[model samples]
Target: MVATTGRGRQGRGRQKIEMKPIQKETARQVCFSKRCAGVFKKASELSVLCGAEIAVLAFSPSSKPFSYGHPSVESILERFFGSSADAAPATPPRHPPAAVLIQALGRQEKELQERLEAGKRRKAALEESLRGPQWGPVGDLLGAWRS
Candidate 1:
């Protein structure tokens, strides 16, 4: 039965797009977001259907982690690996105060600036010492200065 045409498309022309690497970074990120959501949804469905304890952890191209876990990852890991893996660092709250963060950052920046200036002074002293014998020997000089 060589009756030509009609592969159930109502005689419409269909263009087959070859899967290729996305050129633009933004476009790739958007595509990754869409596809990551789709995959997570599928994983959720599969876990529900098969009644299986499952986990899927993925990293985006930018190295950000995205994960899906059924019946809690902590419980599942405890059942298999051990409870030791549950020693996670304390997480920040859902929202933090901007003023508090800014103040903390300011304090850190000031401390770092002071340290940097101290380091620069130490470096200059070392360089000056290296320039001539008048600055004297270099045996534990920095340590001596610290004391």
Candidate 2:
């Protein structure tokens, strides 16, 4: 956790540090930078020490981007967001509505039926071609040799 010294002129301890607006702004910025670095360091250490993949993204006070990750940020994000194919199952299956299941099965059945019909048509066309007039010339030549 990042610690911050309170703002304003009133606080515990002697007035060794003057709490002016400029000084306050400077201290805040410095604290922010330090904390950002600390957080990234901690994240990297945690990933290494525990053998856990981690990704840390921090935006600076100036809106700049900074990031650190173990074994690449893309893999870490993929693991977290279910984009990795090798990632283990993280959630149990939910029971879907029967109506929805029936609708999905119906759609699948329709698709399979269409494919079967197409396949039958293709087979019929192929068989018809093999048995049609196109084979007559070859058959006549072969028949002549047989005769």
Candidate 2, residues 5-26: lDDT per residue as tens digits?
6664444554464645434667
- Please report, in order, the local distance difference test score of every candidate based on alpha carbons: 0.76, 0.76
lDDT of 2: 0.76
Q: How well does model 1 score by local distance difference test?
A: 0.76
- The per-candidate count of clashes, in order, stands at 0, 0
Which residue pairs collide in model 1, if any? none
For residues 6-90, write the lDDT of model 1, one tens digit per residue.
5643443566667999989999899999999999899899878886776777798799998887766655555567556556423
User: Which residue pairs come into collision in candidate 2?
Assistant: none
Q: Which 10-residue window in model 1 sums to the lowest lDDT?
A: 86-95
